[model samples]
Each structure stands twice: as C-alpha cells, then as structure tokens.
Target: MEAYRLLIADVYELAGLSRRTSEEMARAVGQTAARWHVLSVLSDAPRTVPSAARRLGLAPQSVQRVIGDLVDSGHVEAVDNPDHARSPLMRLTGQGRRALDELFARSEDDRAAVVDRAGVTAGELAAAREVLRKLAGALRTSVPHP
Candidate 1:
C-alpha cells in the first residue's frame, strides 16, 4: 500500500540519519558507533560476543572486530564464562563506563533538541516505537532469511 511504502521510506531515512548522528557523538569521545554500541551493552551486564551480537542484531564477526578494538584500548576486558570456555563474557571496564557515560551526556542534549525541534510529545515517540517494534516482528516472521 502507498501508506506502508511511505512509512518504510521514512524509517529507512531515519535509521540512516540516526546512525550518522550516533557516529558523530561517538567520535567526540574518540570512539566509533560500533565500539560504543558494544560498550553500551556491556555496561549493563557482561555478555559473550555472540550474545551481544544477537542482542544488537549484528553479525558476530563485526562485533568481534569491535570487541577486539575495545580490548586493545583497555576499555573492555574478557572475563571467564562458565557456560562456554572459548567464548568469554565481555565486561565494560571503568574506562569504558566513563567513555559510555560521556557519550550519553553528549547525546542527551541532541536528543532533547530533536524532540523540541520536531515538536513531538513523549507519547508520540512511544507510539512510534511500538509501531516499529511490531513491524520488525512481522517482518522477521514473514520475510525469508537468506
């Protein structure tokens, strides 16, 4: 339907813009969006690379590369995982937490500006999020994976 097409187009553009903005914010703290995302997830709790990749809906290989970089920078550390010997859980170190927190602070103002500029209420954002969540679930079920 025409409506669906328009909605999908908007979603596509929004996603691209969001990623660009996120990357910009991450760069301010000497990190990339990919690395920042990994650190953000690990900030909540430790997760193996595969687990984190699954949660982020990203390829394990890509996440692995970012994790490697994070490890080299001493922002993240691998802790032993009882369930999997080879797959160690990734933990955000104090340095990673600080970096993540700074990134969050930087984005907070941008987020506020977006809401004000768009003149959208919190409820509108929530409703839009719910719609997108449902669409993602429907697509997962209806679309065939390669």
Candidate 2:
C-alpha cells in the first residue's frame, strides 16, 4: 500500500512536470499545450468534440472551445458526421499536420532523454504502463457514493 501511494505521488509529479515541458514546447511552435493535445488526439482520426474530450480527459465545453480555435486558425476543420447531425467530427487539416509533425520533431530529444535518465528497461516501462492501465480501469468502474 505504501509503495502504491508513493507511485501515485510520483505519477502526479511526473504529470505536472510533463505538462510544463509540453507547454514550453507548444509555445515554441506558437501553440498552447491544450491545443497540442487536442491536435494529437485528432491526428489519430476524426472524432466528435465530445468523443475527443472523453479521450483527452477534458471537459466537452473546453474541447469545443479548442476545436473552435483550431478551426479559426485553419489547423482543423469540422466535417459532417453521418451518425450525428448536430455533432460534427473534427479532422486535422494540412496545417495542423505540419504543426503536429513539427512538435514531434521538437520533442524527440526530450523523449530520448527520459529513457536515458530513467535507465529503466523497456520491459519495465511496459509493465509499469500495464499496471497503470489496470488501475485506471478499476478506478473508472468504481461505484460512486452520494
């Protein structure tokens, strides 16, 4: 239990540090971390605003705002959704792809440095990811008490 508690703390700190680093990187590319994240999520495939928000663990309204901004900046576009008329799917534009590609190029070094600094084996990383996923699933399914 103590080890688990420590792991949670470490994860929290890591997330904060990562967010800051991402913010810096995004700023270098003339974007914010929130925009970068929304772009990354859209890069995989077009999704409705709500769906993208769920994937990003962000509020739907917040995601909607980012999507609106992206559209205004010509980074993303809203396409017709066959399944839902009211909710359109947001897809990446060429400019968005270029920006995302540039961001990836910029972060390559930081990603490598994390591996070098941690000195953790690939297997260890995989195991850690699996454990975190399992815990996340459990937490997501937990019953809420009023």
Candidate 3:
C-alpha cells in the first residue's frame, strides 16, 4: 500500500541520481550524457537511428540529434544501411570506444564506492533488480506509447 507508493517515488529519485552519475561520467570523457548514451548503444554494433532509439527507449529525433553531435566530435560515424537507404547505420569510432571504456572504468569505481557506503549486498541488489525488471516489464506492456 504505502510501501508501493514509496517505491514509485524512490524509483524516480533513483532515476535522477542515475542520470546525474551518468552525466558526470560522460563529462569526464568530454561528452554529454546524451552523446555518450548514443555512442554506447552503437558500441554493440552498427544500428540505424530508429533501431538504436528503440533499443535505448529514446525518441528517434533526440537520438538523431545526439548522433549529429557525436559525429561532429568524431565519436561516431554513419555507414551505409543495407536495409534502409535514408536511415544510415551508426557505429562507434575508436575515439568513442576509448571514451566509453574510460567512462565504464570510472563508473565501476564509483559504483563500488557507493555499494560499499550503502552496504548493499550483491544478492540484495540482484533481487532488487529482478523486482524492478518485473515492474518495468509490466509497465512497458501496459503503458501507451512506452
């Protein structure tokens, strides 16, 4: 009851914290969080803007804007998309990979510090993640235009 309500608020609060942390991590690599996110998504493989947007749960236009910024910064490059003529596929450049790798390492250190301070066990974190995933899955299915 009340706990569920509290959980909802906590989730949003956590999201804000996550965004701030991500921004800081990205800043360390001389990039904004938005640009970093787009690069990170493309790190897996070359993907069309729409496909990357879908995977990141971001708007295509927003992702496109970030992609433009990344391209300007030499972090990402656009390649031919065999599937779509207009929608070019994007991939991370060497600079992007290096930036992402540095960000990940710093983030890992920050995470370890936070985990130590919070005294949250790995098992507890795993359980919480599973519960959150279930709720997120349900919400994604039920929400309109999620």
Candidate 4:
C-alpha cells in the first residue's frame, strides 16, 4: 500500500517533468505541446480531428484549433475523408515530416540528459515503461467518457 502510494506520487512528478521538457522541445520546433501532439498522432496515419482528439485525450475543439494552426503553417494538410464528408482527414506534409525529424533530433539530447540525471539502467527504464502502461490501462477503465 505504501509502495503504491509512493509510486503514484513519483509518477505524477515524472509526468510534470516530462511535460516541461517536451514543451521546451516542441517550442524549439515552432510548435506548442498541443501542436506537437497532434502532429505526432498523425505520423502513423491521417485521422479526423475527433479521432486525433480521442487518441490524445483532449477536446475535439482544442485539437481542431491546433490542426488549423498546423495547416496554416503548412506542417499538415487536409485530405478528403472517404468515411466522413464534413470532417477531412489530416495528414502530415513533407515539411511536417521534416519538422518531426528535426524535433526528435533536437530532443534526443534532452532525453539523454534525463537518463543521465536519473542514473537508470536501460532495463530499469524498460520496466518503468511497462509499469506505466499497466497503470494507464487501469486508470482508463475508471475514467468517464462522453
């Protein structure tokens, strides 16, 4: 019980630290956290705003705003959706791919810094990732959805 309580506090701390570092990296790539997240989710495939929002666990309107900004910046493009006529699927453009690559490269140093600071072995980090995944799955079940 004490271990679980400590784990929860540690996870919250880690989440805050990660978000701050990620925001800095995103800013360097000319994106906000929301924009970066949207681009990342679309990296695999084009998705409607609603789909992207759901995956990101964000409001659709918020995601839509970020999507619009991405489009305006030519980082992403909207294509005709076969399934939905009104909502087009958003895909990354060549520039978007380049930006993502650049972002990753820029953030690599930050990631390394974190690992060095934590002094954690690769195996330990892997284990941490598995634990976090399990925690997320458990929490997802208790969260309400619209």
Candidate 5:
C-alpha cells in the first residue's frame, strides 16, 4: 500500500509553498490572496460580496473585510446592484488590473521553475491532472449533498 503519511506530507508542503508564494507576490503588489481573488473575480464583471464569498468558499464576513480593504486601497469600487437594491456589486479598478498583470507574470515564472525542477513532461503532468480530477469527482460524488 502507498504511504499515506508521505502523501500527506507532500500535500502539506505544497500548500505551504503555495500560500507563501501568494502572500509574497500579493504583498509586492500591495494586496493579499483574498483581495487578489476578489479583484480577479470582478475583473470581467461586477459581483456581490456574497457571490464572491461563495465562489471562494470563504465566510461572508471575511469576504466583506477583504472587499473593504480593496475599496480603501482604491483597487475596487462597489456600486449599487440593479438586481438587488440592498446588495452592492464590486468591480475592479485600473490599479487592480495592473496589479493582477504583474502577479500573473510572476506566477508564470514560478510555475516554470517548478516544472523544470520536477522534470516532468507535459504529458505526465496532464495525466496526473486528469487522475486527480477523477479522484476529486469520485470523492464529491460519494458525499451526500445537503
């Protein structure tokens, strides 16, 4: 049988590295992962805070905090939602777009480094991704929906 401990350790390390990288890049662009994610989501179209929270699987309060920070930083603007007068819609500002562009460039370079270090071919990575997707789907299917 495969060593579950080893798999868990690898997953933990990857998660840590991902978070660290996101934090470093986000700070360099004067934002956090939550803020970045919100801006990215609203880049194409405006969205309500609750919608953004659901997409990110975050608490509404947490998303609200990030949204407030983004608004204070002038990276996003909140406007009245036409569909729902009570709910406000958030949209990205030009500054947010510029920041996202810079972060994406850095992320691309970081991903390239990881791929080179892993020495895994594109085909191998694609196969692994497919397997992981199937596994995730199976797990989700096994769980009863609320």
Candidate 6:
C-alpha cells in the first residue's frame, strides 16, 4: 500500500494548492468554495437542490447548506420549482457570476504555473483527464442508482 499512499499524498498535495487558492479568494470575496460551486452550477440555469447535489457529486444536505449560505449572502436566490413545489430552484446573482469569473481566471493562472513548474505537457494532462473520466464512468456504472 506504500505506492497507493504516495499516489494519494501527491493528489492530496495538489488538491491542497486548490484549497489554499480558494481560501484566499474566499477571504477576499467573503464566500466559501462550497458557495462558489453552487453559484457556478446555477450560473447557466436555475436548478433544484437535488439536481445540484447530484451534479456536484455531493450529498444533498451539504449542497443545501451551501445554497442556504449563498441565499443568505445574496449571491443566489431561491424560486419556486414549477415541477416540484416542494423543492426550490437556485439561481446565481450578478455578484456570483463576477466572483466565479475572478476565481476561474486566478485558477487558470495557478494551473499554468503548476504545469510549467512540473514540466507537464498539455497532451499528458489531457491523457490523465481521459483516464480519470473512464475511471469515474466505470465507478458510476458499478454503483446502483437509487
């Protein structure tokens, strides 16, 4: 399991960079990554909490908590879902869109720096992404949908 530990550690370190970057931006903008994700997901169109949760691969409660924060912060709004009266649809505000744009821009710069420092080529990154996608697909198929 030593090899798995090392691989997990490497992934954790890389993920840490993202978390740190997000924390810095969140402090500046006064919004957390969870909140940002909810807003970004709804930036394209309003979505029910369950749909957002599934899209994020997060538990519904976790997504709801973030959505509650966004709503409280005026970054998102909840409107009645015509299809489901019990569930409300979430939509991003203008401020949310601006925040997402800034975060994405900064993330792009950070990613480029990492790629340059690691001497990783675009093709290599693409291949890694493809492999991950296949792995995720296989896992999804293996899991039973409720």
Q: Give the per-residue lDDT digits (tens) of candidate 5, residues 1-146.
A: 36746765776798678878888888886678767778777777899988887656568889899889888888888888989998899988898788878877878888888889989889998997787677657766786432
Q: Model 4: per-residue lDDT, tens digit, 6-113?
A: 998997898777878889888876777777778889999999999899888789999999999999999999999999999999999999988888887888888988
Per TM-score, the best of the predicted structures is 2
* Worst-scoring 10-residue span by lDDT in model 4: 28-37
lDDT of each: 0.90, 0.92, 0.86, 0.88, 0.79, 0.80
TM-score against truth, every candidate: 0.83, 0.87, 0.79, 0.80, 0.71, 0.76
Off by over 4 Å in 3: 1-5, 143-146
Candidate 1: the clashing residue pairs are none
Candidate 6's TM-score:
0.76
Q: Report the lDDT tens digits of candidate 6 across residue range 2-43.
A: 975776588679777777877777667666777767777887
Candidate 4 accuracy as lDDT: 0.88
TM-score of 1: 0.83
The model with the greatest lDDT is: 2
Candidate 2 local lDDT, 1-146, one digit each (tens):
89989999999999889989999999998999999999999999999998998777778999999999999999999999999999999999999999999998999999789988989888998999999999878876893321
- State residue 133's C-alpha deviation in candidate 3, in Å: 2.8
* RMSD to truth, every model: 2.5, 2.5, 2.6, 2.5, 3.8, 3.0
Q: Give the winner by TM-score: 3 or 4.
A: 4
Q: After TM-score superposition, what is the CA distance of residue 20 in candidate 6 from its true location, in Å?
A: 2.6
Total residue pair clashes for candidate 2: 0
The lDDT of model 1 is 0.90
lDDT of 3 by residue, 34-125 (tens): 87678778888999888888777888898888898888989889999888889898999999899888888888989999899999999999
